[model samples]
Target: MTTVPQPLTLRAWRGRRVLALLCAVAFLDFVDASITNVALPHIMSDLGFSVQSLQWVPSAYLLTYGGFMLLGGRLADLLGRRDVLLAGTVLLGLSSLAGGLATNTGLFVAARLVQGLGAALMLPAALSTLTTSFTTSKDRHSALGVWAAVAGLASAVGILLGGVLTEGLGWRWVMFVNPIACVLVIPAVLALLPRDLPAARTARFDLLGSVVVTGGTLLLVYALIKAPDQGWGATRTWLELAGAAVLLGSFVLIERSARDPILPLNIFRVPGLAAANLTGLIGFAGMLSMFYFLTLYMQTVLGYSAIAAGAAYLPLTVGVGIGAGIGAKLLTKVGSRAVICTGALVAAAGLFLLSQVPVDGGYLGHILPGLLLVAFGVGPVFVGVTSAANAGVGPSRAGLAAAILNSSQQIGGALGLAIFSAVGAARTHHLLATGGSASIATTSGLGYALGAGAAVTVAAALVALATVNTREGESPMNKPERVLIVGRSPSVLVDAVDILRADGYTANATNQFDRVLDDYDVTDLDVLVFGGMVPADIKEQLRAKVDALNPQVTFVQGLGGIAGLIAAQVRAATSQETQDGVSYDEEKREVRLTLDTPATVTVEAWWGTSFTPPEPKSASMRVFDGQLDAGSHAVPLPEEVPAVASFVAVTVDSATQVFTVGAMPTAVTQLAPASANDNRLPEVGQVTT
Candidate 1:
C-alpha cells in the first residue's frame, strides 16, 4: 500500500495562498467569537440591558452559527464552494458593519445573529476548500498542522485583541475589525483562488430536510446553553430537549425518502468517524471550559484588569503553538493514539494541578503552569482528531464531515462551559452559605470547573486509544483515489458505483457524459470509464476532452453492460501492471487471453503503428475467470471489425514456459508435456569438487 503522500509543493497546488485565505477566515471566526465577550459589558450598559438579556449578544451568534452549520456544508458541496463562501463573507462583513454602528440592542443583536448565519456558511466552505485543495496526505497534514496552529493562536489573540480594542478604540471597534479585514479579503479571494466549478446541473438542495435538521440542531444547542440557568429538571428545558429529539428523528425519516439528503445517513459508517467526532467533542469541552474559568478567575478573583488578563494568556498561546508544532511532528512518528493519550494525560495533570490554586495565588506560581499543560495537550488532540474525524469519507462529502466535526466541538464547548460553570457556581454558593470567604469561594469554584475539564480530557484520550488505528493516526493517506463512471442510465451508474465502492474504490457516477466535468472533480481522478450504453460520439468527445485535460487519467471503454462487468473493466484499467494473460491476433482482429488466476480482468486491444493507442482501432472487454476456470480461454473480437485492421493485446512482460538450463533448444514448438524419461537433471550435481 502507498503510505506516504507527495509533499504539498505550493508551486504545483497553488495552495499557499489558499491556505492563507482560509486561515485568515478561520482567525476571524475565532477572534470574533472571543472578542465579543470582552465588550459584552459595554454593550449591555449602552443598550440598557439586564444580565439575563446580555447573554443574547453571544448566544445569538452561537445559535445560528451552530444551527445553520450543517446546511452550510451541504450547500458548499451542492452549490459552488466559491459562491457560498463569497455570500457568507459578504454577509459577515455587512453584519459586522451593522453591529459596529448600531445604537440600540435590537440592531446589535440582529447583526450578531446574522453574523452567526454568515459564519455557518463561511466556515464549512473554507474548510472544504482546504480539504479539497490538497489531494495528498502529506500536503493535507502539513496544511492542517498550519491551520491547527493558527486556530490555537487565533483564539488567544482574539482575547488579546478584544481587550486592546475595548480599552483603546472603544468596544465598537471590536465589531468593526472584521469588516476592515473583509475589505482586504474579498479581492484577495477573487484574485488568489480560482472560481469554484459550476454546481452540478441535477443537484437538489433538500429544503425540507434542511429545515428539519437546522431546527433540531438549533433547539439542541439552545437547550444546552440554557440548561444551567433554566435548571435541567425544568419543564421548559425538558420540553425543548424533547422537541429537539423529535425533530432530529423526523430528519432521519425525511432523509430516507429525500431524493438528495443534505447530510447522508450513511456517512456515519466511515471507519473511525464516530470516535473521531466524539474525541472532538470531549477535547473541546475540556479546553474551552479551561479558557473560560481561567479568564473568570483572572478577572474576578485575581483582580486582574481585562487587558492584563488578556496579556497574561500570551505564554499559553505560545505554548499551544509550540505544542501544535510538536503534535504535527509526532502524529507521523508515534501515531495518533500515543500522542492523544500522552497529550491528554499531560493536560489533565495541568488542570488537576491548577485546581489547587491558592486564594492569593499569582500568575507565575499558579496559573502559567496549568495553562502550559492545557496548551500542550489541546494542540495534539485537535490535530489528531481533525484527521481522524475526516478519514476515508471521500471528497464528495468532505464538507459535511468537516461541518459535523466542527458542530460537535462547538456544542461540546457550549455544553462543557455550562456544566462546569453551573457546578462551580453551586459549589461556590454552598461554600458561601457555610460562611466561607468570598475570595476563597470564587477560587474554589474556578478550581472545581478546571478539575472537571481535566477529567473530560482524560476521557477524550481514552476514546482515541480505543478507536484510532495506526494508519489514520500516523499517515495522511486517509482517502482513496476517486473514479468517475459515465453511462446512459442513472440507475446503472449508481449500481456500478456501489460495486466499485464495495471493492475499495472511491467512485461516483453520472448518466450525463456531457456534465461529467461539472458533476465531479478530475483532480483526484484515477480512472474514467465510458459505459457500453453511452453514445460512441459522446464517448469520443468526452474522452478527447479528458485526454487533453489530464493525460495521466486511465481511460477505459466499458464494452460490457452488467454492473459487475463494468466494475471489472475499471479494475483491469487500474491494475494492469501485474497482469499477463492477454494478446491480440492481427488476422483474426480479436483479443486472446489465458487466465491462471480466478479473477475478472478487463483488457484493451490497440491497433495502429504501436500496441498502445493513439492507435486507429481498439477494443475493450471484461473477461470472467469462472467461464475459463478449467483451462486457457480464447475471446473472439466484435464482428464489425474491418478485415484490414491490425490488433495488439497488452500485458506486462512475464516468463513463459520453463525449460532446462543446461541445453538451449535450437527450435521451439508447443508440445504435450515431456514423457517422464525425458526430464532434464544435473548429472551427479555436475560437481566441480
Candidate 2:
C-alpha cells in the first residue's frame, strides 16, 4: 500500500529549511542583474571596452536567460527539478569563476551569458520545487510571499553591494561573490531537498520546438534591446522583428504536432493564467523602465555618484518589505484580486508622481516620494500575481508555469524599455527642434516616458480586476461543499457567513441552532462550525444531531470571532473534493462552460451580494441562451453587467448551480449593452481539456 505525503505545516522544520534554500537561489538570480549595473564603468575602464560595445555586457546575459527559460523549464519536467537545480548551481559557480578570472571583454561577456543560462535553469527548478514541496495552499502562499520579498529586496541590495564592492575591492570581486554564495547553498540544497524520482528513459525531447522557440525569443529580445539605439523605424530592427515573428509562428505549428512540446498551448486554458501573465508583463514594463530612467536621471541630471545613488534606494527597499508583508496577510483575508488591483493602481500613481519631477527637482521632495510609492505599490503586485499564475498547476508543469511568469517580466521589461526609449528620444528631438535648452528637453522627454509607464501600470490593474479570482485563505480546490455556522452572537454569525461566502463557499449561519435543526435540512452540509461562546452540552447535542443526519459532516469547535471561523472553514475545505472544469475568459467576456453530457444548459447571469442562485423566477439576465454539448463551449456573458458581478447560475433541467464571476477580467470602460434584436454571433474559442 502506498502512503500519500502529508501537507507541510507552518512549524515544519524541514519545510522552512527548504524554503530558505530556495529563497537564497532566487535572491542570487535577481541580485546578479543589478550588481553589474554599478560595476559597468569599472569593467569598461579595466577591459578597454568602447562605449558603443559596452551594452553587450548586460544584453548577452538577458538575451540567453530569457531565450532559454522555456527550454529549461521543459527540461525540469522531463528530467527532475532537483537534478536540474544541482546541475544549474554547478554551472553558475563555474561561470562566476570564469567571469572573475577574465581579462578580456569577449571572455567576460561569454561568462555573463553562461551565468544567465545557469539562472534560467535554477530559477524555474527552484520555483517548481517550492510548489511541489509545500502541497497545501496556506504553506505555498507563505513560501511564495518570502520568495517575492527576496526578489524585490535583492535588486536594491545588489546596487548597494555593487557600489561598495567596486569602490573597495574592485570589479573582479563583484563577479567572484556569486561562486562563494553558491558553495554555501549547494550543501544545504543537498541535505534539505528531497531527491528527484527516477525518469523514464523512453521519454522523447521536443528538439524542434525548443530550437524554434529559443531562437525566436532570442531574436525578439535582442531586437527589443537594440531598437532604442537603432531607431524603431530602422531596417535592421524591422528585419529582426519579422524574423522573430516567423520563427515563433513556426514554433506554434510544431507544438501542434510534436509528441512532447516545449510549451503546450493548452496551459493558456487555465483560469486567469493568460490575464495574469499579461498583467505581469505590463507591470514589469512600467517598473523596469522606471528603474532605468531614474538611474540615468540620478547620475546625469542630479550629479550623484554611484555609491550615493545606490544608497538613495534604501527607502524603496524598506517600502517593498512592508508592502510584501501586508500583501501576504491581505491575501488570506481579502483575496488576490483586491490586493493586486490596489497595488497596480498605487504603482501607477507613483509613476505619475515621478513624471512631475522638474529639471531642478530635489531628492527628498521629488524623487523619494515617487520611489517609495512605486516600491510599495509593486511589492504586493509581485506576490499576488505570482500566486495567481501558479495556482492549480500540477507538479508536472509547475516549472513551465513559473517559466512563463518569469518570461513575462523579461519580455515586458524589454518591450517597455524599447517603446519608452523611442518615446523619450522623439520628444527630446522635437523639443530641441523647437529651440528648447538641452536640459529642459531631456527632462521633459523623461517626464513623458514616465507618464507612458504609468499608463501601462494602469492597464495592468485593469487586467487583474478582470481576470484574477477573489480567493481567500485556501484555493477553490480546498473549499468545502457546504458550511453551517452555529452561534449565539448575531454579529459573529453574520461576519463568519460573509467571510466564508466571500471565499466562494455555500455558507449559512444562525443564532438559533435548535430552530435550524427543526426547519432546515442538515443532510447536505459538509461542515458544522460551533462558536466558542456556545455551551458544551448544547454543542454536544448539536454534534449528535448532525452526526445522526450525516456521518460525513465535520464538526469544528472552539470558534472565536471572524478569524477563527475562517481558519476552521479553511481546514474543513482543504480535506474536501472541490468543483472543477469551469473557466472564465476576460477578452471575450465569456465563460468556458463544460458539461459531462449533452444538455440544453441555461446560464443565468446575476449581479448581487449573495453567491447563491436565486429562484428561477428571480434571475434578471439570461446571458447565454444556447445549448452546449458535452465538452466545452464559450458562452457569451452579459455585456452591461455591473463592474463586479457576484455569480452566474447554470440551470440544466431542474438542477441549478451557482459559479463565482466576480473575478472575471473587467474592462476599464463599461461595455454598452447589446440590443434585444441584435443577432451578433458569439465568437467561439477552444478550451483545452
Candidate 3:
C-alpha cells in the first residue's frame, strides 16, 4: 500500500534515492524543454516548413507553458499532486512519441502544443513535490539550489545534447528522447511517491480567471513577438495590446472575487515572497532576452555553426552553476539578501559588458567575460531569490507560491524578448538613419538590447536589496527557550536566556513559554530549558511533532522559580554606559531604579525630553556645586542634595540632569526637550507610586 510520505524518520538510503529521483525529474524537465530549440531547423527542413511557420514549434510550447501554469498549480492543489504528476508524465511521454512520429508540420506543431500542456502540469507538480517533501527552510533551500543549477545547466546542455542527437541520429531523436527519459522517472515516482489521497478539500475551478489570464498572456506575447515584424505603431499591434490589457484587468478582478482563486491575490502581501517573485521575473526576462538575441547574433550574424554556437554557451552554464552552488553555502553566512543583491548586480555588470561589444568584436574579447559574469551572477541570484520568495509560506500555499515565481520567470522571458527586440529594432533604425552599414546597424541594435537587459537586472537588484530581509529569526535566537525560573520573581525567563547562552545553548528570548512549545518548529532543537509552566500535555505534543520532524531536538528544563533560576545559573550583565555616564540600553528588560546624588547629568527618555519642578519665582541654584543665584542662567545645572524621589516624568539630553532637589524631593513634572522655563511641564497621565 502506498501512502504520501509524511514527516517521519526514514532510512538515509531512501531519502537519498528519492532526492536522486527528483534531480533526474528536474533534469528531464529542463532538458526536454530546451532540446526542441536545437531540432527546430531540422524539423522545418524535413517538413518543408517556412521560418514563419516553424517559429510556432517553440513559441506554442512557451506560450502554453506560461499561460496555463496557474491553472496547473490549482489542479495540483485540487487533485492529488502525485496523481496529477503521473498523469502529466504519461501525457508527456505520449506527446513526445506523437511529436517524434509526426508526418506533417501541422501534426508536429499539434504534438508540441500537447507536449507543452504536459510540461505545464509537470513543472508545478514537480516543484510542489519538493515543497511538500522538504518542510525545513534549510532543506528547501538546498532542494531549490539543486533545481536552479539544473535549470541553468540544462539550457546549455539541451542545445549540445539536442545537436548531438539530431546530427548523430535524427531530428526525431529530439522528440523520442523525452519519452525514454520519462520512463526512468515513472518507476522512481511510482516507488517513492506516497499514494495520493483524494483531496479532502476541493476548490471550485476559476474558469473565467483561466480564460482571461491565458487569453491576456497569449495576446501580449503575440503582440510582442509580432512587433518586430509589424511596425510598433501598427494598428493590429495596438489592438492586440489593448485586448491583452482588458483581459489581464479582467483576470485580476476575477481572481479577487473568486471564492477559491486559481491565482491567490493575497500571496503578494508577503513582503519577502513578493519581492523575490518580482526580482526573479525581471531577472529572468533580462536573461531570456539576452539569450534570444545572443543566439541570433552568434549564428545569423557571426556565422557560427549550430554545434559551435551551442558549445559557445558553455561559459554561461559554468558561471551560473558555480554561482548557484556558492549561493547555497552563503545563505547561512550572509543571509539571502546580500547574496541575491550581489548576484543581480554582478549579472547586470555582465550584461553591460556584453553591451559594449562592437560590430566586428570577437567572442574572446567581447563576449566571453560578459557571458561568464552573467552566468556566475544568475545562478546565485536564482537560488537566493527562489529561497527568499518561498520563505516561510505555509505548506498549503507552497504550490501557489512556487507557481507564481515560475510563472513570473516565464512571462518575463516572453516579455523581455519581445520588448528587447522591439527596442533593438528602433536602435537599428536610428543606426540606419545615421548612415551606418547593415552589420553596424545590427550590432548597434544588439548592444542596445543587451543594455536594456542590464538595466532590467539592475532594477531587480535594487528591488531585492530594498525589500529582502537577512534575519534568520526562525532559528533559536528569535524564539525563547523554556527555562523554569524557580523564584517567585518574574525575572527568571530573562536570566534563563543569559544562563542558556552562557551554558552553550542556542536559546531565543520568549516571554511566554506556554506559547513557545506550540508555535516554534523545535524539531532539531537540543536542550529545551523547561520552566514550571511545562505541562505534560504540552511536552507530549512537542515531543511528538519534534520526533516526527527530527528526533534529535534536546530538552533542558530548569528547576527553580523565576528569581531562584536567575541566581543559580548566571547574573545579568549590567547596562554599559557611554563616556558621559549615560546608558543607552533601554531594552525594556527587567525594571531597575538608581538614585542620583547631587550630580549634574542629563536624562533623556526614548524620544528625548527633560524633567523640571513646577514652581516659579524661586531662587536658582546649582545643587551639585551648591551655588545659589537669584536669576536664571542658560548654563544652569542641577544636582540632587540627597536622592531625587521624583518620578520619571520627562527626559532630556545626557548633559541635563533629571532634577535638582533638597534632601526631601518636591513636586516632579515632565517637560519637553525644547522647554526654556523650568517652571513649566507637560500634562501628566498615569501616577505610579
Which candidate number has the best TM-score?
1
Task: Determine which window of 10 residues in candidate 1 has minimal summed lDDT.
Answer: 670-679
Q: What lDDT is reached at residue 487 by model 2? A: 67
Q: Model 2: which ten-residue window has the lowest total lDDT? A: 668-677
Residue 203 of model 3, lDDT score: 33
Off by over 4 Å in 3: 1-4, 7-11, 198-200, 430-435, 470-689
Model 2 local distance difference test score: 0.73
lDDT (0-100) at residue 349 of candidate 1?
85
- Tens digits of per-residue lDDT, candidate 1, 1-689, equal 11111113455645787788888988877767777766667888987778988878878888889888898888876676778888999999999999999989899999998999988888888877776666455666666767777787877888888888888889899889999998888897887666654222123578999999999999998998898789878999999999999999999999877756787776786768888888888878887777668877888888877688789889878878888888877766776667777877888888988888988899888888888888887777766777677666544566787789878888888888888988888889999999999999998988898889889988888888765553323432222377887766443454455455434566766765666787566866788887656777888888888888788888876643334445555655665355455555555544555666554432322111212322211222221112234336555544332333222223322211110112222111111111011001111111010
Candidate No. with top lDDT: 2
> Judged by TM-score relative to the true structure, which candidate is superior, 1 or 3?
1
- Residue by residue across 326-381, what tens digits does model 3's lDDT show? 88778867888888889988989999999888867789998899999888888888
For 1-689, candidate 2 gives per-residue lDDT tens digits of: 11112234457787788888999999998888778777788899999788878888777778878888887777776687888888888888899899999999999999989988998899989987786666555677788778888888887888888878888898888889999999998998888766654211113687988999999999999999899889888999999999999999999999877655777776776678888888899888987678767777777777777788788888888898888888877877788878889988898999999999899988999999989998898889888988888865655567888889988888888899889988988999999999998888888889889999999999899888755663544543446656777766443454444344434455666767567687556898788777656678988888888899899887776222332223333443444332255566656666666777766655544443232322111113556544566886776665645546434555443344455555532320111111111112233223233
Ordered by TM-score, highest first, the candidates read 1, 2, 3
TM values, all candidates: 0.74, 0.71, 0.68
